[model samples]
Target: MNALFLTFLFPLIGFLLLSFSRGRLGENLSALIGVGSVGLSAATSAWIIYQFNVAPPEAGVFTQQLWVWMSVEGFAPSFTLHLDGLSLTMLGVVTGVGFLIHLFASWYMRGEEGYSRFFAYTNLFIFSMLLLVLGDNLLLLYFGWEGVGLCSYLLIGFYYSNPNNGNAALKAFIVTRVGDVFMAFGLFILYMQLGTLNIQELLTLAPQKFAAGDPWLTLATLALLGGAVGKSAQLPLQTWLADAMAGPTPVSALIHAATMVTAGVYLIARTNGLFLLTPDVLELVGIVGGVTLVLAGFAALVQTDIKRILAYSTMSQIGYMFLALGVGAWEAAIFHLMTHAFFKALLFLASGAVINACHHEQNIFKMGGLWKKLPLAYASFIVGGAALAALPLITAGFYSKDEILWEAFASGNSELLYAGLAGAFLTSIYTFRLIFIAFHGEQKTEAHGGHGVAYWLPLSTLIVLSTFVGALISPPLAGVLPQSVGHAGGEAQHSLEIASGAIAIAGILLAAMLFLGKRRLVTAIAASAPGRFLGAWWYAAWGFDWLYALLFVKPYLLICRLLGRDPLDHAIGLIPATVRSSHEAMTSTETGYLRWYAASLALGAVVVLGIIVLA
Candidate 1:
């Protein structure tokens, strides 16, 4: 447990060293500091895991309190790290997958401008994310939460010279902040009501203080969900994620796969106690997840950019996790989160390799028959794509996704079950569609990039993890979180799994039919008026950006214009204006003239004599 703090410390040190270098350091040293630091963090995580397994902590939880953060009338949250199965799972993902992504970045970012700066931001990101998962209290968690947000802004706009990239970074920051505000209100409500921000204490006190379906409890959880939605890029807040591809591909991998987008899922699972008290908000969480998965699936279907497709896929996969959480399939949600990290990281890193190989071209349409030119990337895509599509028993995604589908089914939520099925179908279609169109067709661009040890090591490792081997490494969450209700584990579960697996295969077959070979069918469909309209709509992520502009952005700007100069400021200025005017008038009367002084004195005396006579 003592080694737990070292997980974040290594990356913190790396960030400091790299930041001080100011991009003056050579790429080798910078990579060593950046990638090596995360590797060390990963190593620390392994040691902690070994220790936790060798001698399980009391209550299957360990808390390391370094010092009391502050004490105010018995309200104190400490600088502490809490380790349990849940946080341990997230710790492994953040450090392990993060280390691999960092390694791939070393190769992907070679010869790029500000190379050291990129690694510095990524190291800081790893530090922030680790803090987020490992914190013992909500206040500390929120500090880490905001830390990751700031790092995301910095990394997403790593190419600050490009206005579009900067705008994308700002968009991600602003959108997530909307959720952060809601989460902040939720935290305030929790502390005000429970008198503690410590997570375990809050969980213990919540049920005693508030009955099930309590309005105040519901409000707090709902606000927390709002924060999750924005951070995870669900529903209206999701527009920023697709545009986030304006950054480099590794940044895309880091955000989509292991860090920023998964924060929402982690938040909900972490606060399962509060959510369990508010069933309605929990159901809403499921609805948001269900609807988002379907919508993002459709959006992925029409995307042309290599990364945007994967971006929408990330959103859709997270939607599945949300759906699982909403259904009280807590472990299932977490399980999918873990498995998604494996495959999604593989896909993004491989996509980066492909882009670099093809001279940085990202259009799937522009990259065809590349399987021969780049066999390693091609294999990476196949393995990663199969896992993403959840192609039956061979891929890790099938096991995790099927668990979610079964949970939805077992919960007897027909609507959610259907949504999960549909999203799965859509996921398979678009995933294989990308693979077929990008890898199988005639070669459209000349592909040439050296396949060094840097490229193969990380990509190969991820490829292995994306397979069924990764599925075997389950999160030890049996006692940590509540056991899932409604898990019958009978023929019914098998039937649903088989059915869902069939649906996945069907979607892949459809993708092959449509995208493989000549792609005339997809082309014709695209050329049709209705197809064109639908494609555009889906491609714009169901017109969310437009709707937000109309509903929120436009009105805000219009109000700003109407105000012109704040009327309250003008009103407050009147007292100062009057004082200044009187001062000027009195100053004019004080002219240096003896006659004027004598006249004033005579007037005063006359007034005095008049008053005396009257008296």
Candidate 2:
């Protein structure tokens, strides 16, 4: 078997083992398998990267075919793996960071009753995500897409005993399903038009086969965008991600930060050739991403819960990535994806450590002055926060996010550029707002105390990576993508870097002034109408449960009542009544007495003879 298969296979093996063990395995053994599987996959991914560097695939791509998985009516979808710079980058991030999160979870979830089950779901999520990145064709990709959705639902509701968690998971599944339906239709249209689902072949044929403004291409692109939007928690479909903070912190790190959410960005980047064919659709992507960026950033600004703040922040950062992909900056988008996976995962895990130490307290107002006690977590949080805030000359987020902003400005999409800049400012403000409020305030609650090295070790490792990984991508990523795609300039200039750095610093200062230096200012603002609106998520999320109740539950009950009296029951009852009448009529035709049976038989014979004579 090829190494690509092993990347997916090992996690699946862990899932199966842990699943079968059913909470029976010793805690140590369960943790080992869970972490080990992803660790091995990470090692395998590194080897694959080494091989690719040594003997780079033609045009920076490689393919491995497993077998013909299915065929129908001259259409065949194979179980194949395609490796390229794109897939390789994603593989390393998913398995590498994924392994770290798993290890972190082992310590984080040490005393939880469902420790084994938690690992099982985590491994399964890894397996699905690997399949998503490694798949060669659309069918296989869809399989992986749904697989990850299932895993997400399972992991989000890992604490099944909690009704709120279950509801959150269901909401995620249902909302994403709406998008997945469109994605499925889009895939069907592609196969019907192109006659193949192989991504490489599709890319090769897409340019010549489809016209620049073809309606089918536009529709297909939009449909696929729907999927991306839902998965990435873009505007209108973003509510679930905020609610998903109900899951364990490691789950948040793995799913929201590193793996599951990035799939959407990956989808757009992987299909750059198809998207390039449709400029209108590309513009739509920019518009949606830009709007989502602004909306989510504002949402992040007011959230009190630490994870909800990160959740909204994740949405905003993903919006930037989408903006990059939208403006034809594929390489920059993927670069940001990598940087995001590192720092966001770090931030979430570090937050988890803090939340654990504080006895499950997540309210930023309740947390303060633990920087001295949980020094490692504090340090990791700072590294992650710097990356998030895009501080000058220090963090990965600065490099990747700044690159996207430059591309957006230089891409002839000025409106999008302006929106992106505003979002950037907000991003910086909200990120550090969380940092200063949570870490820099006076201690209000008693510290529940800190943990052993096992807890801090994974967070520290991520912190180091978060600080450094941004610079590694320029050479490899810039080399692959065409110059026309990224920005007007060939590479990032010092002046542009300084300007972005300045914007970031300004945002930080502004946040400090409003939330920290002048606390009364924020309080006064919150007393005002606009601040109230901001706190309420601009009313987008207000009465959400009630809206669901009125729209889904109350309406369903009304329909049930109406149907019960007027239509549904009566219509349904008619079928059984008609069957009963038919049975009674047939019973009359059949006589219980032997003499009646004989007479009927004789009558039938006489009738047949008469008909024959007449003919």
Candidate 3:
């Protein structure tokens, strides 16, 4: 079998075996299978990358046609895998980061009731995401898309006994379903016009088939953007993520960091040609991304729940990716995607340790002076937080995020550039606020558990990668993408870099004063009326949930009640009662009495004679 096929199979086999294990598998065996499968896939991806570099093929594309999936008149979708530079980049992250998370989940969930089940779901997610990145056609992509959604629903509500977890899973599924509708329509339009679901064919023909400002192409791109926005949790579709903290921590690391959230970015980058044809839609993508980053940052600032803080941070960072894509910086977006995967996963795994350490207490105010108790976790958070804040010159986030700001400036989009810079400052403040408050205060809560090889090992590995991996991989990534990716011009780029770094530094200093300083500015702000109002607003995620409730939820419930107890049901019910009443009235005539019987006989005879005569 081809290496591409093998990469997906390893995870598939692992998921099947563990899912059907029925509690027969030991913890060690389960961990070995789950971790080993993804590890091998990562190894395969590395080998593929090496081979591609040593002997590059035409257009740097590799196609493996396995079989026919479906066929119609002049149209067929195949079970094919397409490996190119872009996919290769995603493959490394998905498999590499995914393996570490699976390893962590094994130890983290040990002695739990559904240990095998958790690993099963994790492996399934890895398989689904691999298919998503490697699919050769839109049909396969959509299959993988919905597959991951199903797995996320299962895994997010992994603690199914809790009603809140179930609600969160349902909310995530229903919200993203709205966007899937638009994406399905988009596929229809593209297939109707182009008569092909093959991705390479679509890319090759889109330019020759449509003009720069064509409405049809714009409509299609906008529809696809709908799916991207919902999947990436941009703007209106974002409320579900904060609630998703109800799941296990490893699930959070898997979905938010390396796999599902990045699908939207990959979709946009993969279909860059179609987006390029519709410049109007391209600009809109940037606007949505820019607005989301700032909005999420405000929400993150006041968030006290540690997991929810990371949830909002995920939204904010994804906004950066979208902003990069909007400014025609596809390479920069991918770079940020890779680096964000490593650091964000590290932060989540480290936070998991902290949560477990405090006996599962998630409130940051309740946790303090953990630097000594959990030294590994402390070190991991410091590195991860620095990367998250885009700390100057030394961290991975600075390189990738600053590259985006430079492109935005070079594109003459000062508005976008400033929006990005504002996001940078907020990122710094919220990230360090968590660090200082959680690590610098008196020990207010008793702590236990969360010290083991599985937890700390993943944390340490991610820390190493987040620190230096960005610089090492840039040359390979640049080689993978087309030549035009990083060619934005001039001295202004350098100025923006320095300015972004300075902004990050200033925000960090401000955080030191607000959360860790003597005046207790965060508390003071919480005390005031305006600050209280804004805190409520931001805590409610600017009340997006309430708005949707009024707009969609209430109306939906009303309609359901109307259908359930409609007047038509009463009308239909009345018919049976009417028949019973008529029957009773007719039965009264049959009451036993001699005179009545004689009269009835005489009347019956007369009526029969009259009927005979008429006939």
- Tell how far residue 33 is off in model 1, in angstroms: 0.6
The lDDT-based order of candidates, best leading, equals 1, 3, 2
In order, candidate lDDTs are: 0.92, 0.84, 0.87
Report the alpha-carbon TM-score of model 3 versus the true structure: 0.95
Model 3, range 1-615, lDDT digits (tens) per residue?
A: 257788889999999999889768998898888888888888887787788778866777788999998778867799999888788888888988898888788778888778888888888988999899999898899888888888888988999999999999999998888877888988999998888878879888999999897888888899899998888899778888898888999999999666799898998888888998998999999999999999999999989999999999999999999998898888888989999998999999988888888888899989988888888889989999999998887788888888888878777788999999999999999999999888877878877646677877888889988885664576345544434344655676677777899999999999988987454667888989999999999989899999999999999999999999989898999999999999999899988899999999999999999999999
How many angstroms is residue 84 displaced in model 2 relative to the true structure, after the best TM-score fit? 0.8
Candidate that would win on lDDT: 1
Q: Model 1 over residues 1-615: C-alpha lDDT tens digits?
A: 788899999999999999898878999999999999999999999999888889999999999998999998898889999999999999999999999999999999999999999998998989999989999899999999999899889988989999999999999999999999999999999998999988999899999999999988999999999999999999867888998898889999997666779999999999999999999999999999999999999999999899999999999999999999999999999999999999999999999999999998999999999889888888998999999989889999999999999889888899999999999999999999998988887999999855778889988998999999999998989888888876778998888889989999999999989988888998999999999999989988889899999999999999998787788878999999999999999889998999999999999999999999999
Q: Which stretches of candidate 3 lie over 4 Å from their true place?
A: 475-490, 517-519, 573-615
Cα displacement (angstroms), candidate 3, residue 398, comes to 0.7
TM-scores for all candidates?
A: 0.93, 0.90, 0.95
RMSD to the hidden true structure, all candidates? 3.3, 5.3, 2.3
lDDT for model 1, please.
0.92
How does residue 608 of candidate 2 score in lDDT? 100
